[model samples]
Structure formats: C-alpha cells, structure tokens
Target: KFAAELGRGDKVRFAGSTADLKISEVLSDAHAIADDDPDLETLPSSEHALPSEPATFDVMKRVDQKVVYEKVLDELASGGTLGIFPEGGSHDRTDLLPLKVGVALIAYSALEKDGLAVPIVPVGLNYMRGHRFRGRAIVEFGAPTYVNPDTLDSYKRGGADRRKACNDLLEEIEDAMRSVIVSVPDYEALQLVHTARRLFQKSPNVDARDKQDMSRRFAEAYKQLVARAGTDPPQKWLDLQERLLAYRRELSDLGIRDNQVPGLDRERRHAEAGNYDGDDVLGGGRLLYHIVHLVWVLCLAAIPALFLNIPVGILARVYSDRRRRKALAASKVKIHGRDVVLSE
Candidate 1:
C-alpha cells in the first residue's frame, strides 16, 4: 500500500535483484562440526528447496538483475523516488554499518544511462526506546547529495575504474548519512550520553529534533574523548561520568525521568506558562486534587499496561532473542534484543 502510494498508479515490486532458495541441514554427521562452525553451526545449506508451488521461477522473475536494474532506472527517469537502505539489512547497532555498494551502483547506473545526476537525500531515523510501544522517534533529513560527475566519468570509462567509482560514491553516501544519524559507540554509552544531555539541558521543552542534534554532537565528542583517553580518562571526565551515572540510576529507581523530577517540573511548568514568581506556590486544595488525579490515572494506566504487556512482552522477548542469537550475526542488540524486536 505504501509503495503503491509512492509509485502513484504503478505496481511497486520488492527491490532485491535476486532471492536464494535454501533448505536447512538438520542431520549433520558430527555434533563437534556443528559446534565448531560459525553462527551457532546450523546455518542453512546451499541446496535449493523443493518448489512446492507451480511456476515458482516465473513468479519470481521480477528478481532478475537486468529487470530490477532497469526498473530502478525507470523510476528515477520518471521523477519517482527510490528509498534504499544502503546498509542492506537492519540491525540494532549503535553505529552505522558499512554501506553496501548497491546504492552507488544505482546512482552511477542512472547517471550513466540517463545523463542525469539524481539527488539522494540522506534521512536519519532516530528512536528513543525503540522496540517498545509508544516509543518516540526523531527523523532528520540531511542535504541532498549528487554523484560526483568526475566519478561518473570514471565509471563511464569502465573496467577497474568502475569498481572504484562505485566505492567512492558509496563513501560519499555514507558521509551524507552520517551527518544526520545519531550514532553512539554502544547502548550503555547511549544511555549515559542521553543522561548527560538531560543533565545539562537548559530548557525542559527542547524539541526532539534539537535534542537529537545535541545527542549526535555529544555522542561524537564523547566517543572521540574515550578513544583519546584509552583505558584511563581524565579525572574530571570520570567524575562527571560518575555523577551522571548515579543521577540516572536514581532517576530510574524512583520511576522519575530526568524531565519529570518532582519540584523541577512544577517550577518549569510555571515558568513556561509565565506565571512563576519568586515564592509563589500551588494551593493545598489544588495539590490534593492533583495527587488524587495522579493516583487515579496511575490505577487506570496499570490495568491496561498489565493486560497488554504479558503475552506480547513474552512473545517479543522470545522472538527477538532467537533472531539476535540464531538468525542475525550482525545484530548488536543487547541480550534481550530490545532494539530489534518488532512486537513493539
């Protein structure tokens, strides 16, 4: 449906050039061999699975390289958009994966065939508590990128120069993506970086986009500092890290988010509303009414939360864990696969 909308009236097909058919090899001769092989040993065999349905290849002929390649070029030539994840596959990593060359191939191919430089805009998909229900997201678009004409000329020359052109174009795409992406070294550092951002944030109502920009800047600087510091960071940074860590821990334990600290929230709200005086206070009756309202809301929230969480939570855990451990070797999601779970 989304693809149909994007393509207007045209039928939109899966973008892959080919699909491999493989079957599992459950009867390995030796348990030792299974254990010794990488990715938990039981990877699918190269043998093609039996085609249970008629005209399988005919049905799947859309995957032909030339056909798909021409289809992409047609889309570009028609002024229709093509969205490609240059990573080739999804993962839960805190950093960008090495980009596949396919993006460059498409770009270069289009430029060569049509003599037009298609503008590729980099988009960052930043998530807060991704893989959870009601999680927040911040999308940022970087500047439009054009394939270098010089590189296109090299590709036109053909041979080894073409390979280098694709690679060079891929590097340019990566740099463009990196400009908008909010990347961190690891999930643990991600938590700390966010906590530090919250700790130093001057305004309570800074929008998510600006917050994402701040996080990117902070994560980059922090990552650089850690690399330079090696095993031993400067004492000042260590102390700051410790303080932020403890503060975050306290916040978590109290079920209080950084923006929801008790006294600070009220003052901030009042300040935002332009009603704060040096020593003004909320009335006792109003406070009592708010406290009761909070309890009632909490009670209402707990009922639905408990009912919704149980079955879905367990299923999400099992599925995510299996995918992270058995299916995805490149996944960097934690033990629980919190970042990759689709159940959320």
Candidate 2:
C-alpha cells in the first residue's frame, strides 16, 4: 500500500543490481527459527510481517559505503537522480520510523568529495488502505533539501562533531517526511480522521477534485484538530467519532458500506435523476435490472476467476511458502473495500 513520488528525471536508476530484484531472491521473516541447544526446529515468530510477493534482500554490495558513495558520486557526476528509501524496510505503522543514517552520510560525503549539489528529497507514501486490493494511495513529495558544505566540514571534524551534524540532517529529513504523511496520534485517531474525511467531504469547503489534494487537506485539518485539542481531544469531537464508528459498525454488520448508504449526496443525486438507484434502496425496476446485469457479469467473470485467478493465486501462495520456511509479513492500511486478500 505504499506510494512514493520522484522528481522528473531523464532516466530511472534502481539502487540495486538485477540479481536482487527477483520475487524469490530472499526469504521472508515468517520463517525464522530459534535454536534451543541441540534442537533447531523452534518456530516461534515475531509480530512484524515482511513483504510477501517481493523477495527481500540486502543489496549489501550496493549499500556498502565505498561502493554506494562511489556509485552515487558517479551518478550525480553524470547528472543523475539517485532515489533511496531511508526507512531500510517497510512495516505497518502510522508514523514514520527513524531514517537510516546512510542517506545523510551519502549527501554529506558527496558534498565533501567535489562539492556536489545533492538534494535529499523527502517523499511520503500515504495509503488509504494499504493491505486491500485496489486501495487508494497518494504520494507527497516534500521540498528538496540541499546539502550544506559547512555541515560536511563539521562531519570531517570527527567524533561528536560528526555525529551532531548527521543527526541534525536526519532530523530535517524526518520533519520533511512527516509533513506529507497523515500521521495521527494513535490508531483510534487514524480511524476517526478517516471516517471524518469521508463524511465531511459533503461540506462545501472541502474539494473532491483529487485524492492527493484531499490528503493534504486532511493532514492540515488533523493538525488543527490536534492543536485545538492539546493533550486531550474535545468531547464534541469524541462524540462525533463515536457516532461515526457506530454507523460504520452497523453498516459492516449489515454487509454494507458507507458509500452504499442511500443518504450519501452523490447517491441522492443519482436517485433523483432516476439514472441509478443506490445500493441501499433495493426496490424499483432499476434494482431488478441491476440484479440481472450483475448475475450475467458474475457468470462471465467466473470463467477468468476460476481458470486464471484461482490457479495463479494458489500457485503463488504454495510456491512462496514451499521455497521459504518463513511467512513474509507486511503491514498495510486498508480503506473503501472488502476485497482484501492478505499476502501469505
């Protein structure tokens, strides 16, 4: 469910070699075992789930300091943009984790080498529902941070001086990354904010032109709400959240979605125009037409679903599971649909 944005460039250069890019190059974390004395079959696991489909591998040769610095130096020297995700690995979390220091070190070292004008761009991957199939995602790119030659000089000083310079640079990157992400205080807030955004878009003030714009607006709104609430959210906000969650829960129990509700403004317009009937309203000739249309569609869909999708899905799970002793665990946020199929 992760999304990322890169600045326009002449060519895209992957950070790793061709060998490390395969789907089964590395094993997942789900297969780790603990060795207890003479016994080596202990299979207790941790909470973290790595990515399932994509094989995880450490492109150690590319990441090595000498190699990485030389490679990046050469790229920049030839007017190339080197993209890197400083998080090292992906996991399911609302907030951004501590960035790898390698990015800062690279920029600093590059600046020192030949005063290369390197810019560290912080991009945020905002997923509406990460784990769900067809879930929406938005990529927000923050301002480009240019390397400070003086900062590199401090790094050259060695010891605490070097550490402080690097830390400061890392902090800057973190702040930039945070600016674009919808980082709520907790899971409850995350749900509340999402629910609110879906409902509140009915208001005239909120524009629905683009998902990315909506994300930015939501981030701004959440920031303001946090500011107003201080240590604790207002009781009114809490009450509203409770109501929204309750409504959502009731819909879930009935096997319906919020968008399926008849009262939705978009649904109302369609109903009034007589062009379509909301899924919530099951009466009228339109409903019968829809039912018939759906049946035929499903009948046609079954062919591909059975022969193509089912076999491929089964083969994928079986092959990945057999080749590795571990399950690849990855965390994803989901929104909108119930069509989620977890990656094994």
Candidate 3:
C-alpha cells in the first residue's frame, strides 16, 4: 500500500529473515565477536530445570531469549539490520518498556569492528479505533546515533558506569519516540509500576478496581503534563525538564514514594552512555523538503491532467482561484462595489 501510494512500484524489495540465509564471505569477514556470554550461562540452566507447571514453562521461555540478543549483535556487526522490539513483546497502547541492552551491545561491536555506525530508528505503529481498515499512521525517522568504542570502554570499565550509560541511551530513544509519536511519560509510567507494587504489598487482597484507579491516576498525570507543556516551546531543554517534573508529581500523587523514582538512575545511565543531543523535532529543513516535494507532485499531476484533458486540471484551477480570492478578501480592509482596499 505504501509503495503504491508513493508510486514506487517494483522498487521495494522485501527480504525474509537474514538469519535463514548463509552469510556471504565478505560480510562474515567484517563481523565482530563480542565478549558478553550471559546468554550461554542461562541456556543450560533453563534446560536442566523441570517444567512441571505453566509458570516454570514460562521461565524456560525467557531463558531462551538470551540467544536472540547474541545473534542480533552478531548480525548488526556483520552489516545487517537487526530488527528488534526493544520491548520483548507487543502490548496495547503502552509506552515502550525499558529498552533491552542487546541493541547497545550490537552497536558497540559494529563500531569497534567495522568502524561503521548503524542507525537505530524508532518506528511507531498505531492502530485506529479498530485494529484494521483504513486508518492513518505516521512513521518518522530519527537522526542516527553512533556507538563509539572509546565511549563503550569507559562504561565497561565500571559496573555502575555501564548501567548509567545504558540508561541514558534508553532515555534518548524514549525521548525520540515521544517527540514524533504519542508515548506515556517515563516518570508517570514508573510511578504506575511503583503504585501497583505498593498496593500489592499493602493489601495482598487488592481488587481489580484498585488497580484500575491507580492506572487512571497515572494516565491523568501524563495528560496534565502534556497539556501544560505545549508541543511547541521556545526552549526545549527547559520545557522538557518542566514537563518531566510535572510527570514526576503525577507519580508522586499516586502514592509512589520519592525514593522509588528512577530519575537519578536515568540521569546516571544517560551520562554513561554518552547521550548526545538530537536534531530539532520540528525544524525548517524537513518542512522545506516536504513543501518542495509537494510542489513537484502538484506540477507533475497538473501537467499530466492538462495534457490528457482530465477533469482534475479544471478542478485544480478552480481550487487555486478560490484560494487566491480568499486570500485577497482576507487582506482587504474595506470593500466598495467589488473594489477592495487591501491592508498593506
């Protein structure tokens, strides 16, 4: 559908899973090997455990995920796109869960081995009132970020350092997603989790209604923050901080303890990860390109329609005339017998 809309028929090539194909010699030669081995350690332990119950079986399934991370890193290092859901699985209208560190490792390895930086683009997929049918969806591509080895080395040298870096990168991605797409505020989300935990602890017999109330409160807080922080602001840094604080308050009001807030952890990770500023979310550059493309498209359609004597050309002329008349009327300070005095 996208290809047809874009008039790019037969130009789009869809590839199946890269893992199924044998790696070419040239690509294999460029692949990097990572030292991380957590996947290997967890695999055997999972297999040995008895799956007597459903919960036990679920545990085994989680253990199996270790290999996926390792494989993704290897593929990325080999100059291939590793499609990963930072959140392990799909959820209904939830902001992204804390990003798994697997993509970070892949980026680090790729930079170290090939000196080639891979772009991690956040894709937002939204469904309308129903899951299917004609619905509007928008996909915005974020500016690319590279993982440097010198940067990674600094984090790897210290446990605390690495965790801090990881968190920062995750936050950057979250911010990027939020800029182009609708997402739950991080602080409010964390508060929701905290509220749920506290309620569970206090009343082991908590009902579904209590859980619903806690969720509703958190959502309300997020809405308030978004409203207070207009989408367009003069200073994004100050605006973001203010919005974050508002979101934090929302969480606080939901019985989430101050000590439980993840702000400190988020800051620490951002520093360690060497998080950098991204391009403006709504800048003149993209707008200019879109305008130019639209003009070109209009010209193309106009010429073809006029040459073919299609009714569209007539409609376009009428539409253009109406727009011009409206503009003229809007600029008029006074009008006397169709002779209008336009405001200078």
lDDT of each: 0.68, 0.60, 0.48
The whole-model C-alpha lDDT of candidate 3 against the native structure comes to: 0.48
* Residue range 1-344, candidate 3, lDDT tens digits: 22222221111111210011111121132232223323223223322232344321010011344577567667776667866676543333334443556666656555656666778776655322222223444455556555554677655665656755655666666666554444454434544444444443455455544544454455556557566867853486456556656765776687765445565678789778875445543565788899999999999878866777767646655665565456444431111211111110
- Model 3 residue 190 CA deviation in Å: 19
Can you write out model 2's per-residue Cα lDDT over 149-210, one digit (the tens) per residue?
66777899986788778878877887788766777645566776776666666644443334
Stretches of candidate 3 above 4 Å error?
1-71, 148-150, 184-344
Which candidate leads the pack in TM-score? Answer: 1
Alpha-carbon RMSD, each predicted model: 11.9, 13.1, 25.2
TM-score of each: 0.68, 0.62, 0.36
Candidate with the larger lDDT of 2 and 3: 2
- RMSD of model 1 against the true structure: 11.9
Off by over 4 Å in 1: 1-64, 262-336
342 Cα displacement, candidate 3 (Å): 56
